[model samples]
Target: MPFTIGESVLFFGIISLTTIVIRFLPFILFPENKKTPGYIAYLGRVLPYTIIGMLVIYCLKDISFTASPFGLPELISAAVIIVLHLWKNHTFLSIGAGTIMYMLLVQFIF
Candidate 1:
């Protein structure tokens, strides 16, 4: 199905407005002059670790220790991520390298 010109304009207009509102909503909610609420501040401090824990659990939930690979790929990838993060203190580098390593292991090695 092809969108008519007016429909396309409306669609793009809605997307643009949504993007702008999302980008500015944080500043509008948490102004520079006002102190952040204690709970929000606490969440900001704690959510990263919580989310990482959740992701780790989710990622490893399906592993079968009795299987052929025996979770070596995940273990090695996690080790690489830990070492890279510790050595360089860079989250993106560690996560990206770990993901690439896992893919390569799954495709070629394991």
Candidate 2:
């Protein structure tokens, strides 16, 4: 079907507004209290691990089992970050080092 520019703008505007309202309505209407309930506190504690796990799984979902040099740099960088974080307990250093290593590896090796 042919769509005019005006119609496309209006359609997108309506969708954008609807999505914004739906996403933010709860936060706007019901402000959180300082003392959250037990269930919510438990959820807040668990949510970070859940989100990180989901993100890691999402990133690795497309990885091929067969060895490929293209994926080695990322794997090595991630391992460096993990090892540094585990051993040294330095979040920023781990991330910064891993990122620099990844950049260098990508620029030189790949």
Q: For this target, which candidate reaches the highest TM-score against the unseen true structure?
A: 2
lDDT of 1 by residue, 15-102 (tens): 9999999999978998889998998889879999899899988979988899889999999999999999999999899989999999
Q: Tens-digit lDDT track for model 2 on 47-104?
A: 9889988998797777665766657888899999999999999989999999999999
- List the global CA lDDT of all models: 0.93, 0.85
Candidate 1, backbone clash total: 0
Cα error of candidate 1 at position 58, Å: 1.1
Q: What is the TM-score of candidate 2?
A: 0.62
Check candidate 2 and list the clashing pairs: none
Q: Could you tell me every candidate's TM-score relative to the true structure?
A: 0.54, 0.62
- What lDDT does candidate 2 reach at residue 10? 92
Candidate 1, superposed: residue stretches over 4 Å from native: 1-51
